[model samples]
Target: MSSHDVHDEHLPAHRSETTPATEPIADPGLPAHQWRPTDVDPAAEKRAERQVATMFGLSAVCTVLFVVSYFVFEIGEVTTTIAGLGASTVALGTTLAGALLFIGIGIIQWARKLMSDHEIVEMRHPAASSDADRAETVAAFNTGLEESGIGRRPLVRNSLLGAIGVLALPVPVVLLRDLGPLPGDTLKSTIWEPDMRVVRDVTGTPIRPADLEVGDLVNAEPAALFETDEEGEPLVEGVELQVEKAKGAVILVRIEPDDITPGPGRDDWGVDGILCYSKICTHVGCPISLYERTTHHVLCPCHQSTFDLADAAKVVFGPAARPLPQLPLAVDSEGYLVAQRDFDEPVGPSFWERDSR
Candidate 1:
């Protein structure tokens, strides 16, 4: 090796590490803190306190008015009009809304004006704690609890509790209103009568035997479901009747007469080649309308529960446990279709206590 190479190996290869230049660094501290007007001026502080208190005071008054309005306005009463809304609705809505809004404004004002406004910086240490550190934390928590003085200041605590307790009253009161009268036996019968003519649902035209071709499916309702009584009174109307008809709905289908295998007592039910069955799926009450005429099977779109219309509407496929209910069909003197009577059994999805007999 050359002498230069030998000398270079003996010398320390460059500096082992690089150190930043050690000069005294200047500290850039936080900017000067500005005091609020309320903190410096006694008059401003008093005014701000009054403003917050006024907001809270108004909120209390509105809460009282909410209670009053609950009784004052009858729910459906029609009185003076403001922009086409009833005066009671407007008053109740505004007063109740103001009650909540004013309280929120009051809390915001209190925090802005009166609550401690000092900025604090906390230095975080490692999350894992030693016994000594935990003891110190507990001591600090006790000191904070003592300083908060919540137990001694009953006015604020009591008022807060009162407001919260009063707010809970309406929840139970509204729930009690839901426990009112229920419809009994109303769901068991529809507007159908002994000789009511069967009609198409929307067009309201009477369904005649000739109107249905082979394999044709028709959605029909009892004529009484749409008729007025002799005294011009509607046989059924409103929610009670609607729910009844939904469970008693029927569908009429016309197939070849020789295709049918009637249930034990339903031989005389169909008129000519026409047969009728309930529209509701016995499994989950979905309207079963998808028909396969060649197979004589009607499929429920919901769960694919297929029923054999040719054999007493028996369950032929899918999850349904029972057959669809059959409606007896007859023709009136005018050659329009009519129901023999109300369904012999209840219609709709089977319940736990349902009796199929």
Candidate 2:
């Protein structure tokens, strides 16, 4: 009978009979170890080495191709459609995927065929170990290293190192492309120009100062966006036109002329207390429309960023990092409100290494 069965047999039969409980038994040693096919067969080991080396070699080639693709294709080129996809996109994606795939395959192959594949069974040890236990652990680690044969396999080791080293090359090169041409003066300017009348967004109707009440807030855009050429065709259309309109979007608010406070060098910028500011939030580019007439605060629904329109659109509360960019305003000869010029500074969030001017 097993020890557990024997212990159970020795239990007291009657409730009146008192007896002490037996202590828990200790664990027995581990089962016998087993060897793997690669450990016993030289042919299998050699085949595994070749397979791993091939994977590493393929990975190295993919890395080289990634670098080549960086220069070969223009970024926006949209030719060579495969299911309506660009050739540059396909080449770069496939090469990069192959680079990662081969390296993963190589490591898996090495672990399955070349690295130590012995089945070891370890006995349960105490939670806290003694000096002897530490020594035994170190000895086992050394034995495992020897069994792996990494020291003897120079070809596999060097090839893997080379593949991994080459893999690093594409990373820096890709990042270099990001570090290329910056926005420069693009951020500092918008579609707003001098004498361009302020038009209502979407309807494209020119806004006169009389159209707005004291507490009214109207979403406005540059009048130039709605302009038609001599042929009666839209000067700007499609994505390009949409982008320009979005960046140039503004909010027109009319308050008591005495309530408006024009900043330094901006005395004549407003028309009859009708001040205008970029609708795009300076915090993170959310379209702001919420207006509190009593406070003169325009609140961005995203991030709850509040800008005091009464005080040059200064950041009064919330996560906004900077004040909203105000557009210089004036009245045209026809009584329609117009922009004096574009914004004095950039209208969006600060970016890496960006110069605001």
Q: For every model shown, what is its TM-score relative to the native structure?
A: 0.55, 0.74
In order, candidate lDDTs are 0.75, 0.84
How good is model 1 by TM-score? 0.55
lDDT of 2 by residue, 1-357 (tens): 999999878877885377679988988656665666777889987878888889999999998888787668665534655576776678788888898899999989888778876567678989999999999999989998887777989878888888999998665668576674455555778888999999999899999988999999999999889999999999988766887887899999998889877777878878888999999997778999999999899999989999988888888999887878889888889999989888888866656544445
The best candidate by TM-score is 2
Locate the minimum summed-lDDT window of 10 residues in model 2. 73-82
Q: Can you give the lDDT of residue 168 in candidate 2?
A: 85
lDDT of 1 at 146: 60
lDDT (Cα, tens digit) per residue for candidate 1, span 1-357: 999998866877455356568998788666678788877898986787667656656666666776676567664434666687776668767776776787778667756765556665668888999898899889978865564433543444455455545545763464365474333443345556676788887666899899999999988776656777999987777765576567667788888999989998999999987998889898888997889999989999999999999899999899998888877888889998888887776677776656544
Q: Give the Å error, residue 148, model 1.
A: 9.0
Tell me, what's the RMSD of every candidate?
A: 9.6, 8.3
